[model samples]
Target: MLFKEVIGQESIKENLIQTVVNERISHAQMFQGKLGSGSFSLALAYAQFVFCSNKEENDSCGACPSCLKINTLTHPDLHFSFPVQILGNLKKSDDFISEFREMMISNPYSTEQDWYGKNENENKKGIIGVDESKELFRKLSLKSYEGGYKVAIIWLAENMNIASANKLLKLIEEPPEKTLLFLVVEDLEKILATIISRTQIIRLKSLSEVQISNQLANHHGVDEAKAIEISTYVNGDFAMALHEVSSQDNSQVFFDLFVSWMRLCFKKDVVGAVAFSANIQKLGKEKQKAFLLFVLNLFQKSLLGNFSGMENVKITPSHKEFIEKFMPYVHERNMEALHTDMSQAYYHIDRNANAKILFLDLSFILFKLIKK
Candidate 1:
């Protein structure tokens, strides 16, 4: 991925480029951003720029052997460490490298949910185990194949287990000479403080609506009007915009579930809410979190609509009427608590809590808070 290929973040691209041009690159750096913000793509571009022998003024020379190798994710000096579902003998990231590469090639903006959903293991839990960290250590300890900087890009670094995180933290402390470690992460809180202290943080902001709209129309062949509409509704999340343009059914299903769940909460219908929770438990863990995030985003939009007007908010058209009715319920009195409880539910779901019980409890909490 070249810096120019990333949708937005021109300033960050320049900063990364300057690091290479000035030969002042940090040994350990963390690329933190929201899901779909192109942090992964940026990290890859930065690596390519560092390894490019025929570097351009603002980007890597794509024709160079080093650039071509990294572009295909086959560069010996470029290593990727990511979360992997332990399936029998396939316990390490390398065991699933082919699938990961395919995913990146298909959609560099894919979210964690997209990854697990496409995994061959039916979206099982993925984690960076101790073994993966050990493997990474051994690989980095070797001499650089290109006699240049050895780049280790750890995607979803927060997925590393405590043991793995500790083992990797040691490497960060005493990193090999001419090594660049890029820890690309979505959630900073999940990362260890020890590791966090050791790495330079490179934060990527969400893309603007205009940026997303242009990408959709210019690259994805989406019609201008539809692209603009999708971009507005996605709240600067490029992945969500792509999903909308692709006409995926996940958002529709999530919309229906949110409406039903909200109605149940409004009426304090414990029986109905319990049934809804039971049904939601059937979704994969990642999907469950995605659903909660959707709900939270809706809540945020509704709150904005409440303060201003519906015209000022960019909710899905099919959801507008429902949100208009729901807006009054989510006000200053309860919006914070609503966000808190929903966020907690998402956190618990990610941690492998009993989904049925967790969602059931969350429904009860929402029943109280939404009434405020």
Candidate 2:
């Protein structure tokens, strides 16, 4: 991907371009950012630009042979290492390289969860193993086949196991001439300090709401109003905005359930809350997780609306209708208490706590808080 094609982050693009122009490119660099921030895309763009035979002033020439191969992620000199799961038949990320290429070509803004879903391995965990780290050394030890810089893009480098991370430390410290390593990391804290000290860290900022809305409108044919709505809810996450648009409309159901739960909480209706929890427990795990996240987002938006004075808060049509009627009940008096309760609920859900007991307990606490 050419740097020009990446949306927003004009300053970051300029900085990266200048690095190449000045010949000050670091041997190993870490592109650190939250999910959906385009860290991987930026790394790919930089790699393409670095290896492009016909490089332009600010970006790679897309028509060049190198650019073409990089665009398809088939560049002989460009290698990738990422997390993989050991399923029944699929043992490694390389085993599913075809799917990986297709997914990246289709949407580079995808999250780890999206990748897992595409591979139908959402229930399993993925990690970079010692074998993968050894393979990295093997690949880097050899000279470039195409007579250009060898680029290794390690996506989600923080997922590397202890052995892999330690093995990679020496490589990061000193690699062969004309070798570049781009480590895309979501959580910098998870990476070993030794590795961090060896690589130049480039922190990526999330796209602004305006940038997201504009891109959605131009690229996806979404109208300005709807694009803006999605942008607000997405909170600078392009992948999530795309998912929100692509997924089925379950906002009404979520809103109804949220309203009912809130009412049960306010009334101290323990029996009613228990029944409600039992009903929610019957939903699939993904649905349950989605519902919980939706509720969390809704609470955050409500708090922002009440205090942050950010008028651009976007809720679904049903949610807007409900919130308008419900806003008076969610003022400063109970906002903090509500946030605490919601956070506790999220913690419980994340730990695989019994959904029924978790929700019931949360409802009881909310009942006390709502009336406080």
Best by TM-score: 2
Candidate 2 runs further than 4 Å off? 87-93, 223-226, 265-270, 273-372
Local accuracy of candidate 2 as per-residue lDDT tens digits, 173-282: 77877889999999999999999989999988888889888888899887676676666545577877788678635555666898998878777888899899999898
For residues 1-372, what per-residue lDDT tens digits would candidate 1 score against the true structure? 888999899999999999888989999999999668898999999998899899989998898999889878999999999988788988889998988898887888888878888875555778999999999999999999989889999999999999999999999999988888999999999999999999999998889879998999899998775576566546567887888778756777888999999999889998998899899999878678768877887898889999999998865577789989989888999989888988898788879999999999998898788864
The lowest-lDDT stretch of 10 consecutive residues in candidate 1 is 225-234
Give residue 209's error in model 1 in angstroms.
Answer: 1.0
> What clash count goes with each model?
0, 1
TM-score against truth, every candidate: 0.72, 0.77
TM-score of 1: 0.72
